[model samples]
Target: MKTTGTVPRLTARGVATRARIVEAAADLVFERGVAETGLDAVLAASGTSKSQLYHYFADKDDLVLAVIERQTERVLAEQEPQLHELDSIAGLHRWRDALVGLQRHGGCVGGCPIGSLVAELAGSDRPRELLRAGFARWESFLVAGLTTMRDRDELRPDADPRDLATAVMTALQGGLLLTATTRSTRPLELGLDMAIAHVEAHRLSRSVQPRGRREGPVDAGPARPAGTSTASRSG
Candidate 1:
């Protein structure tokens, strides 16, 4: 969208070449950051010449937009199943466990694919808007699950799905940042745990505990004598 003009239509081979360029750029940007990654590196990694790269992308900015879109797609694809199943508190915990497991497996190397991009590109309007849209898409999944839970009487009527979703997103991003910085999953676990705890605090009934948690047998105070009224007992 800058000095390089718009991308032209491409044949099948052209499409594949363009995809290679974008994927390579995405990987480079993910590893070295947007500033450190250059078109020369992308070309080398993708095995495409400069002319071919320019044929599909207007400029480095255009390539970056493609990278953001690709990363967004990759992330959402990975999260779609768990995000869709978030209607129950147990399901939320399951999703959290999956996320922690992922970080643990990766040793928390990358904070978040999209989050890293956002951190670098937020100063720019177009990239920021694109990243914001990507985040919105992710948040929508959470909102849908929370809305369903609220409608099903699992959550308090006052619980706002959007607000809770925002809280969860904030916790997740923060956790991922800390996890990557520290190379440990503890921060991520705590973040998700606190977020879920916040959600649980808004449950419709505290008497009914979520799965995997046990409540001690209720001590219903001393039983009242055989149908005796409080007035008679006081007298």
Candidate 2:
């Protein structure tokens, strides 16, 4: 809940107004995208005037940043606990299924907000920096989970927790992007399957066991074979 830099203080009405604007903006961006959605559209959607919009954000860039922050907070809030619960392969499968279900049910309409922003601001330093910071926070959360798995002996001691965490995130983002472009959930589903398989294969085991088909069961017996130990670089 804590953020760096100077925090803005506002009256109750002002807070409500800002919240409404942000909510509207998030929805609009998801539905139409950042490039297609404009300030007037956001104002109209939020039922606010130009002056009111300006009161909250200095400009479109400022509003975009606020929306990005809101999205980052939402994603972390939803996934943090789930990521922390991945002390076993079963928990990891459940998380993967839940993620896939989200995309499937939504028809892969909108890609990841952070990923979308990264693509949108590919050439701009400021937005790219913000996007990187957001991704870093998410990756850090995943790394914490991976570290716990290592401590629990669920993962191999030789596994680079940070690198694997980044790989998982990168794969998820790539899958989401592919799904969005193709308007099909197959890519996302397959990508998650591969990611989970990669993790399961590399786990500290002795025999090569195939990944499980069920969504919420840890089938990695004691004799499972360990996969390769190389760390995958992030994109």
Candidate 3:
């Protein structure tokens, strides 16, 4: 969970170099795909010589794993604050709209980078393991946000935050896959709406009491604060 900028000075430059290589590799892989991308291409894109490249990444596979980790951090960084603010229906709606907007704006060219890695590495143990770890970390972040909602009574008392987080993660990955294959955003939009509906349906509601004139009971759900969607806001 350490920020990339706070690494100790002893190997700061080396860490920065490695990060640059990973970033370059991720961008290339996303643009050209794994099958077409090569180590030489990554080296050229990163502006790192062969020795430096080898020093940072032992091989193409190692670089690919590093790219996966880099993408994981990038995705989480983009999502954190907004996802953490999902304690109200309005906030959740913003989150969903942001996701839809991202795909629409990107021309649906880029789905989830982690999901792309998983597809490229299907049946490969090493890559699969790396992907599993990345997804586990991502799911943990979502679960933390859901737990916050539960604590604020925004979610039903008996709701399983972990399960809800996992379901959301599953739907996102599946939706991304469908979007990539069909070159359409409909599936992603529909899947996200269903996910939001599920979350809203299980949202906690409180009994409200009327004031001076008359006494009546009212249903009060979570209150919304000024919030923005991370996905829609991302570049």
Candidate 4:
């Protein structure tokens, strides 16, 4: 969030006020949207005037960047200890359940805060790098965990951590996108299920003294296979 430029150092009160504006703006944008939510709305919500809003953010784009950072933190925070220990299958399942619970709790309102913004502002160059960085950070965490799994012989020696990690994200984002489109968590559940299955499939056999599903994260029943579900349409 720190920009490279000459700027006035804000007093402690000023810092709090600026955070207040950003928090209010974040809430507004998440509920309404970046295009629809205006600076005046942020001003009203934050209980600050135009000058105060501008004092913190150079413009709406600056505010958007801050919101992006806020959302990145929020999303990563939701993953909890599982995110930190994604090297194991149990951690992956925990992460998946956490996401499912999150979608169910929020009623699957916004797909992803940062993701929604990118869909709206993808054409803009200013925030693209920041957005890229945000996604990359999340991916990096997965990559690190998967790498550990590979190194510890939990994953097959031939497995590629980078590709597998990215694929998991692909499934996750696809689910999120579908969730946003249909207003249901089914897609999210299916996507993560497949992604976790794919990851678990690479486990090294115990013949090699490797950690298997029994020693790590284990899900009940065989994976529900992508696209296989019990729900049906009634005529």
Candidate 5:
């Protein structure tokens, strides 16, 4: 989160080295809370020296920002191709299922890596902003999907995509926190299920014929906000 004038240019090898260090830092921080993971631990885990770390990062906090960025990318990565295509109810369901699968795969131990980081660093302005930015990126995808549903008349004209997107994100976050606390994915599952069901009312009847049989790609409705599908817009 510390800023130093213009960004420094790095060669291919330097970029790789910095990436290796960031990856190590992200792993350590995810496994153990950020406070517990120190420069020494990062160095040991990353197999890098003090000079090498300092060359790329200003300090522990600076490195942590990098780790945050890394973890954010990982979170988005897990939701990939589905995350990119979340413009309909069916897409939302797919995204929800994929998220639940991630928790189940981990036995629900980590409790939303980015969410936990936000809770721990809430007091720090830079960390908090970065965290918020990451969540915003995630939220934007929902907004897009929901907006399309509305545009396609798949959702009620009165429904608000932005608001619904925020609600869905809140549900997922709350559920993840509870899941982490309870060590069960049920809370998260239920939360997502309810959130998805909330959208059922807004969906066009034709899309839900016979109940639960609806399965298809979300129609590409209306023009999208430029770059909504890209990483830049996400941040």
Candidate 6:
């Protein structure tokens, strides 16, 4: 609840202390889950006293919110590169490949950091909204890139970036959940492939395609095993 902008600025050491508490809480929740991770556990893990924890967070829920915010920032930062490259079919394929690779690298152990939170926090209105906002922010990145593609006439005028981005985001979250549950990257790969294909389906006809646009069906890239460390903690 004590956002940086909402509260008085903390000294450098105070900022680090607050961050340590949030990081510790996030780790504990990731390991034992939200319901099992108590404030005492957070205090023990963070090496901070009750007063220190309460000084920053109003309660357990407040601390959890901070953890969610931290995880959201981390997730977005990890995916920013690929998210920015979704302006074309080729770029989208490359982004999809990157996500699948990351899942394989981590052996599909963790579902998306933010997505996993949804399952645990859905009943809690405040946390649920926070998680929703996180997903929306993630979708916005795709929306921006897809908008660029539409602007360039690569996609049909009727192709709504918001809708396309939502489809892609939904596919990603569902795929990640399945991949983590099955300990295989197949679901993630398939989800992204189909999502990209959906986008490609909206492409302009070859006859009307712009001069610089690449011709032919979008290549699915070489058949290879998935592997990437970028989002290892994201799952």
In the range 1-235, model 5's lDDT, one tens digit per residue, is 4333345888998878888899999998998989988888888988889999999988888888888888999999888878876776667767877787777678778888799898689789988988999899989988888887777777878889888888888899998998888877777777876677677656775543433444433343322222222211111
Across 1-235, the per-residue lDDT of candidate 1 in tens digits comes to 2322454556899779988999999899988999999899999999999998878877889889888988988888877679789887667877887787776676678889999888789999989988998899988988998998888777789999999999999999998998888887777777877787778777776534344554222332222221211111110
> How good is model 1 by TM-score?
0.85
lDDT tens digits by residue: candidate 2, 69-183:
8888777776655767665566666677666666666767787877877767767876677778889998886677678777767678888888887788878899889878887
Q: Report the number of clashing residue pairs per model.
A: 0, 5, 0, 1, 1, 4
The TM-score of candidate 3 is 0.77
lDDT, each prediction: 0.79, 0.72, 0.70, 0.78, 0.77, 0.80
Listed in order, each prediction's TM-score against the native is: 0.85, 0.82, 0.77, 0.87, 0.84, 0.86
lDDT agreement of model 5 with the native? 0.77
lDDT of 4 by residue, 116-207 (tens): 77778778887777777878888888899889888887788898998998898888888887887788888888888888888877887552
TM-score order of candidates, top first:
4, 6, 1, 5, 2, 3
Off by over 4 Å in 6: 1-9, 207-235
For each of the candidates, the C-alpha root-mean-square deviation to the true structure, in angstroms, is 12.1, 7.3, 6.8, 3.8, 9.0, 4.1
Model 3 has an lDDT value of 0.70
Off by over 4 Å in 1: 1-6, 206-235
Which whole-number lDDT from 0 to 100 does residue 111 have in model 1? 86
Model 2 Cα displacement at 160 (Å)? 0.5
The runs of at least 3 residues in candidate 3 whose Cα sits more than 4 Å from the true structure, single-residue gaps closed, are: 1-13, 205-235
